[model samples]
Target: MKDRKSARTKETIVRAARKIFSEHAYHTASIRMIGKEAGIEHPLINYYFPSKAELFDAIIREICEEFAASAGEWFDAIREREITEGFTEFIELLMEFNRHNPEPLRILALNLTQTKDFSLIPGYHRFPDLISRLHTLYVEKIKPMGPDQEIRMFLHSFYFLIISFLGAGPCIAQVQGMDPDGEPYREWMKATLLFIFLPRLKDINLPRAAAREDG
Candidate 1:
């Protein structure tokens, strides 16, 4: 019973901290605020988390774990498909994931762009090396869109753009007078992204790097 109670208390602290972190970002959020939100005393919170940065790191790690679980199904959907189809699956799965768990992504975006420290962005260390893996995969799977730098630029730009979308999607939809949390918004995004990128894919003309090796 004591262990169960301790586990529950830890979860409560984490949930409260997640909410507070989401609202205030990392620097501005305090242990007192998290404690208050959790309805536990600040000292008690210290027992569970030694420092505010530690708590914040914990939350970021937790979010990564959350997405890691959801990402499996996404990979399953796109694993054997054509490049464009896989891309489509990527978009759809992310959209669906956001539908259910929007807060974590918003928190991530808030930190990624808002942190003043360019040297080490907050929560930057915890993320996996997905960018490098994706880059390698693109080299093997798709034709060269341009020189290596331009292709990398495309990937990097799309990354930040997608993170922005994941974070501020509701705000953007609302600005355009649509229901941000509704199906119409989802379809609108799907159509919009495809319309913008699919044609670019053709124009960019990426040749498969694997064929170069074969030849």
Candidate 2:
């Protein structure tokens, strides 16, 4: 019972911290603000998290873990089988992840736009593995043209596509008289991303034989 209570308290603190961080960005967000948002005393927050930096680190870890798990599942699913036209479904899964986790996405946008110090964010330790896993998956699916750099560019483009749309938010969409969170816009983004990537996928060089493999 005590452990459960503690867990709940920590979860509440995290929820409040995510909202405050999204609204104020990391540097501007304060412990007092998070405490108030969580309906807990500021000291309670300090008891759970030693400092604002630690709290922010916790959030980053949580976000990274969630993304790693989701992406890992998709990676495992396509390990043996080719992605082929399953790219559409993959894109939709990414969109769905962002849709359900807008707060974390907003927090990430703040980190990207305001600080840009990715080192401060947690979960990057898994990045090398994530990239390696993705390389294997893409190598199987696209059978890329040249070297790892070509594959790296493709992966970077995929990252940018997801970030660009998620970072836009309602404010950016409103400028164009569109709703970023709406299903119509999501479908449009999905289609646009697919249109941009499908040709590249199709144009990629076929897989080299075991003797000529460059990966």
Candidate 3:
């Protein structure tokens, strides 16, 4: 069943490798396993990527580019709305993004979140660009709220909680005796996140011009 001559061998390999990496994480996944999952000869992988680390970087870049494009669209879509309306829409868009792109979330959990040093991946260099793209969208939350210690704490909470939700939401749902894939839990999570975050958005004044300028 190994068809090495496929015209899209590189793409095939990437798809297969993504599955393996997302399932196994970086340390446990091997190129040989990727090749087997790819139904490709091991040497053929070298033609596309110099090494496993480079391939991992390639995947990270792919995900970063994908997210950057999505975040831009999300930012534009929310620009005209009132603050609460925009924040609500943004959260739904993020949930939809996670639903559609669960693989990226899973891969992130596997490779990044479990470790104290998230820079464990060789592709850490691309993180600044990724953060820049996200930060652009993130400013919507920060702008009206202002970048205080509370806002910083909110960012940390958002990252840790959202990632945890995405990674283990089903198990948590099950523990609560809810259907993991049912609408109930999905709605519950959205409502829960809003409950946690919306209070911060309520009644917050934008920083004064003087304070903004000083910072």
Candidate 4:
């Protein structure tokens, strides 16, 4: 009973923190605010989390673990497939994931871009491995133009773009006079990825390393 109570208390804190942090970026959010939102004393929050930074990190770690459990298989399958197929599947999965879990992504997108010290996110350490897999997919499977540097930049840009797009998708849709939840918009995004983005990627001039490998 004690453990169950503790678990509920912790979850309540996290849920309150998630809501507060999402509404106000990390730096702007205070433990007092979180405690008030959670209906607990500020000291109780400190008892559960040493600092605001630690609390923030806990939320990110929780989000990453949950995302991994849900989407890990899709990433694994991407490693097994051809680059085009993998990339298409990845984009589709991202759209679906965002559609279902908008809150976490919104929290992440806001905090990540606003913060300079990325060490706040405990899951950040795993990012290198993630990028490494993408590098292999590009170099070994697609063999896209340019060297690893170019591929790294491409991947970074895409990651930011996708996250930002999903985070601000509704606002963007409104601005563009489109419905974010509409099937037509989703289909347009699918076609844009395949016909436009993929085609443009194909146009990048091959670096000497790639050209030599081809030769």
lDDT string for model 4 (74-146, tens) is: 6665654544666788788878887876767677677676656766654455555554555565566444665
TM-score-based ranking: 2, 3, 1, 4
Off by over 4 Å in 3: 1-7, 140-145, 148-152, 203-215
Among residues 3 or more apart in sequence or in different chains, the pairs in candidate 2 whose N, CA or C atoms overlap within 3 Å are none
Q: What is the C-alpha RMSD of each candidate to the true structure, in Å?
A: 4.4, 4.7, 5.4, 5.3
Q: Which residue runs of candidate 2 sit more than 4 Å off their true CA positions? A: 77-84, 116-146, 205-215
Q: In model 2, what is the error at residue 131, expressed in angstroms?
A: 5.6
Q: Model 2, 1-215: lDDT tens per residue?
A: 99999999999999999889878778778999999999999999989999998888888777766776787676555444333445677777787888878776677666676644556554334445555666666666545565777667777687656766775566656776778888777777878888888666544544532223453
Score candidate 3 by lDDT: 0.73
Clashes of 3: 0
Give the lDDT of residue 89 in candidate 3: 87
Cα RMSD of predicted structure 2: 4.7
* Off by more than 4 A, model 1: 118-122, 127-151, 200-215
lDDT of each: 0.73, 0.71, 0.73, 0.70
Candidate 3 residue lDDT tens string, 5-87 = 55488898889888887788788888999999988898999888879999988887887788778877887887656656777
lDDT score, candidate 3, position 56: 86
